[model samples]
Target: MLSGLQRDSFEYSIHNANPVNGLVRDKSRDGWPASIAAVGLALAAYPIGVERGLMTRDDAVKRTLTTLRFFATAPHGPEPDATGYKGFYYHFLDMHPGRRAWRCELSSVDTALLLAGMLAAAAWLRYDTADENEIRKLADALYRRTDWQWMQHGEATVSHGWTPEKGFLLYRWCGYDEALILYLLGLGSPTYPLPAESYRAWASTYRWKKIYGIEFLYAGPLFIHQLSHLWVDFRGIHDEFMRQHDLDYFENSRRATFVQQQYAIRNPREFEHYDELCWGITASDRPGPRTLLVDGIQRAFHDYIARGVPFVRRLQTKKEPTWRGGRGLTSR
Candidate 1:
């Protein structure tokens, strides 16, 4: 079952990709732009496609080359329609034009996701052939070109992203969230590595709380605990925070999942058809934002929101609390 799912997911990436530019569609919808992160993920998935006999190595090579070549040659400037600025891409790009889409900020987290995919491809496509060698070269060039320190914008913590319009985003990636890949990549970058203190600063913001007799680093969204795991093997590795806690991120993720499970088992909100067997709450699309009477309680519901458990300490009298537009509520 799991293998079939994996194969289907990979095929989605393959089929949705633009043939000429190699950009992958963000999602199947009306005129949705290509996502750089999706492109990066597609790059990484190509190797797995080869290993599983789902794709020919030559095909993977072609896809990788086309994608990397487009990115390497894409225009970079402060213009509103530029491909990117400072070597980081916008969250979305036009499918055909391959330029910035939606005028979105140059997303740090999405760019990290993309780079993770790129490095994965570079590591896998190891052959003496000219095309494979070019893949490695392009991957190295792209990674090195990313100015991590520049993205920091003179802050100890990395900014969430930047906009050509307003400059650095107000949000910094304080941890226990999906920004793990962003911080790790910035710290590990050879050309523009972040200071070790940056990681420390980010980790210091983590909140630890115990609920339902289970203690873990408190993050509302389940994906917060899982997104970083995609590129990172947290087992047997300890950051300063993990070392102090006597556990690593892998164990932390396990606890977070358990917390979600317990929350579902309790069904406090009385969401329709929620139980231990049917439990998963990620940032997802739904109807729209409004108040709803669920189980005779007035609950505020939202569309396309990152829903998670109520904040441990931050929640006062409110049933759900959103910190800086973080997340809210459970899902069915």
Candidate 2:
């Protein structure tokens, strides 16, 4: 099933990629704009396509080149319809022209995801061909051009995103979530690196909770525990917070996964079909915006939400200062 899904996902990119440019649509639905993060994932998937014998090396290289070239040359200004501004691309863009779409903010995390894909592609296709060399150069240019410090918005932590209409978003990236890749990318940049202290500032926002008697860094969504590790290896890495707790993120994620299963087994919420064999919830689509009375309880559901095992009292042994702002504590 996993392999089938993998092949399907790679095929989705191939089907959705704009032939004129390489931008992939965020969703398969009609009239949806391109998601930079989805583009990033698509960029990262090409090499896998080659390795899996789903695509030829030439084809993968050709596809990657198209994406890198377009972003490198695309108009990047404060204009309402530019591809990006200050090296950070908007969250959504037009499929053909690659202009900003849907009034989306210049997303720091999404751009980081895109850079991650660019760098990954550059690293994998390391042949001495001209196309491969240009890929490396363009990837570095996009990474360096990002003004990580400017995104701070005069604060220690990075802002969630920026809007041309209103400047920076009021909320900032804090605590631990999918932005783990975002912060690391900034910190690792050679030209516009975020300060080392910024990592500390971000780490300080972590919450240590003993969920199911397993103490680990507390973040509700399972994806939050996995996304960074997907692109960046953290198996043996120990950051400041990890050093303090004597636990690396990789190990913490493992614990979090176990806790997720345990949460399902316990079934505190009494969700039907939640058990040891059936569990694991992350952000997903929901048919909601309506209220229903279930088991004599009136509950409201929303269209889309990031779901996780509820953080219960049994999970807390002490208080940990959390720095996550902007998005709600759990269901963003």
Candidate 3:
């Protein structure tokens, strides 16, 4: 059952990707622009398809090469319509023209996700064949061309994104969220490596707390704990923060998962259908945007939002959070 579900989910992105440019749509439903993050995920999914005998290795190579070639050849400049700037692609790209779409920012985190996918393809396609060698070369070039230090915006930490109109967004990835990949990529870059203190700056905003008897690093959304794990194996790898706590990120995610399950079991907010079985509250679809009376209580719900627990809510109420946009906590 699980394998079937996985196959379906993987194929959804893989099948929806634009054949010409290799960009994947944000979702299969709407006529949305291609999400660079989804494209990254599609890159990662092709290898799995090959491994499972769902696709030929040559086909996977073609798909990966298409994506890397698009990124490598796409126009990158400071212009608003440019596909990317400073080696980071825009958050969304036009499916037809393969240009920047929706006037989105040049996202650091999204680019990291794309790079993760590229690196995965490079690692998987390790043959002396011309296509395999080209994949590795493109992946290395993509990573090297990104000016990580320039994205710092003269700060120790990296900025969230840069808009052609607004310059750098007034946001830094300080707190514990999905930016782990961004920081790690920046730190590991040979050409434009950020300072080691940048990673420390990111970790400094982490909020550790015990919720439902499980102590773990707090990032309200479940995706934050899961996305980085998709590429890097955090098992037994100790960074400065992990060394202090004597727990690796893998264990931290395990505890976080447990805490999420416990929160659903507890159902403190008393939301409708929030039992143990129906407890997944990450970025997902909701019923609607109306306030409904559930058990005589007025409960608000959102439409297509990133819902998270109130762990960071407590922290924000006590002190001002570092990230300007505030943690992505959906109000119930």
The CA lDDT at 155 in model 2 is: 89
In order of appearance, the predictions have TM-scores of: 0.90, 0.89, 0.91
Top candidate by TM-score: 3
Off by over 4 Å in 3: 286-289, 293-297, 303-305, 311-332
Tell me which residue pairs clash in candidate 1.
Answer: none
Which 10 residues in a row give candidate 3 its minimum summed lDDT? 315-324
lDDT of 1 at 206: 85
Give the per-residue Cα lDDT of candidate 3 at 1.
88
Residue 202 lDDT (model 3): 89
> What tens-digit string does per-residue lDDT give for candidate 3 at 155-260?
9999999999999999889988899999988999999999999999889988776655566787877888899999999999998888888899999999888867
Superpose all Cα atoms of candidate 3 onto the true structure and report the RMSD in Å to 1 decimal: 4.0
Q: How accurate is candidate 2 locally (lDDT)?
A: 0.83
- Given candidate 2, what's the lDDT at residue 46? 93
Error of 2 at 71 (Å): 0.8
Candidate 1, residues 165-194: lDDT per residue as tens digits? Answer: 999999988857888888888888889999
Give the TM-score (vs. native) of candidate 1. Answer: 0.90
Better of 2 and 3 by TM-score: 3
- Worst lDDT run of 10 residues, candidate 1, spans 323-332
